[model samples]
Target: MTPRTPAPGSVTEATCTRCQILKPAAAFYANPLTRKGLHSRCIECMKDVGALRREVPKTTAAEATCNVCGWLKPSSEFHVNRRRFNGLTNRCRACAQDYYQAKRRGIIEYQRQHRWEDARVRMASDARRRDRKHGRESDIKAKDIVIPRACPVTGKPIYHGYGVRMAWSPCLERIDKSKGFVKGNWRVVSWEAVEASGWQLTRT
Candidate 1:
């Protein structure tokens, strides 16, 4: 369609609908169908809109708001989610971890109170449950597991069993899973001892 011709001496300048500023007609892109022979938005505003359409927020590596905790954090703190435009989870790392643990085991809040010691205790107990489900003999009681406030060896606080660092948290070690959860078969020990002995302690 051909653009409508402006009335005599009525087309010197036009108002940009977006920026609401009067600019020379040259500031707009030519549009054959518009009454003024140009787009409603000026060139600069149009360029910004175009860039927004093509941009990928997830690939930008900038700060983002976490939907769960309502905190603005670095992009790296979020887990990748294929469904989101930014390719990141709506929750930050810490919030996501809590949500995941709560959803799976429903003890995230309770475990957090003890610095996650309860989590280790539950892990060992869960093994016993699994053994019972599989019809394997398990004498372990969930209430029987004990978590010491400090490591018996190093006398350091036993926070949680995480990471491979020198001060890694304490862990539950089963002397023998084959023997089941019998009274003398398990103990809570520091991760350092387990690592030093080169023994991979199974959860059960």
Candidate 2:
């Protein structure tokens, strides 16, 4: 893979493929495979990369940083989150649990104050995100979600309850599970009805 000899009065400089910067031929490592007989990256760029690799501990290179504890921990300690570049959550499991509980309290209070009609305000983003994650089509919005006074399946009153008493709690159901939350494709039903229908809690 010998490079052709440079012509007389040939250019003495070439651009780095990595940094896209023009530098002297001496600034690059020899590469017989390339037409210019030089490496793709400049010597300085290669050195910087090698230095960074040396600085990071090999055993902890795949570890993630916890947003709450400000500590580097094993990536397994973080929940899987497709939204992040690293495919893991920013906070550790303990911190994420605490944050979820706090957010749940706020959501419950808001729903209570709004008589549950405003549950859509909190779920609109979740619906949109779920559609994108599952690669489904949807045009649903916060205003499109309407909570009924009674469950469509069980004909029971709709209200929130704790633990096993959540049977009567109102939950959204997609008539076509393969499809997204589009208009006329979903309804409000009781959790008990969902259980009887062989369905589990979703869109949460």
- Assess each prediction's global lDDT (C-alpha) against the native: 0.69, 0.74
Candidate 2 clashing pairs, residues 3+ apart or interchain: none
How do the residues 1-204 of candidate 1 rate in per-residue lDDT, one tens digit apiece? Answer: 233345577566789888899988767777867777788888888889888777665464477799877889987898776556777778899997887787867566555656454565675667577667656666765566677888776677776635443555656566776765557877777777677656644642
> Which residues of candidate 1, in runs, are more than 4 Å off?
1-121, 129-136, 161-167, 176-178, 201-204
| Residue range with the least summed lDDT across 10 consecutive positions in model 2 | 52-61
Listing every candidate in turn, what is its Cα RMSD in Å to the true structure after a full C-alpha superposition?
A: 14.2, 14.8
Per-residue lDDT, model 1, residue 120, is 55
RMSD over all Cα atoms, model 1: 14.2
The TM-score leader among the candidates is 2
Model 2 regions more than 4 Å off: 1-115, 161-165, 200-204
Per-model TM against the reference: 0.34, 0.39
lDDT of 2 by residue, 87-115 (tens): 67789999989999999999988768675
Q: Give me candidate 1's TM-score against the actual structure.
A: 0.34
lDDT of 2: 0.74
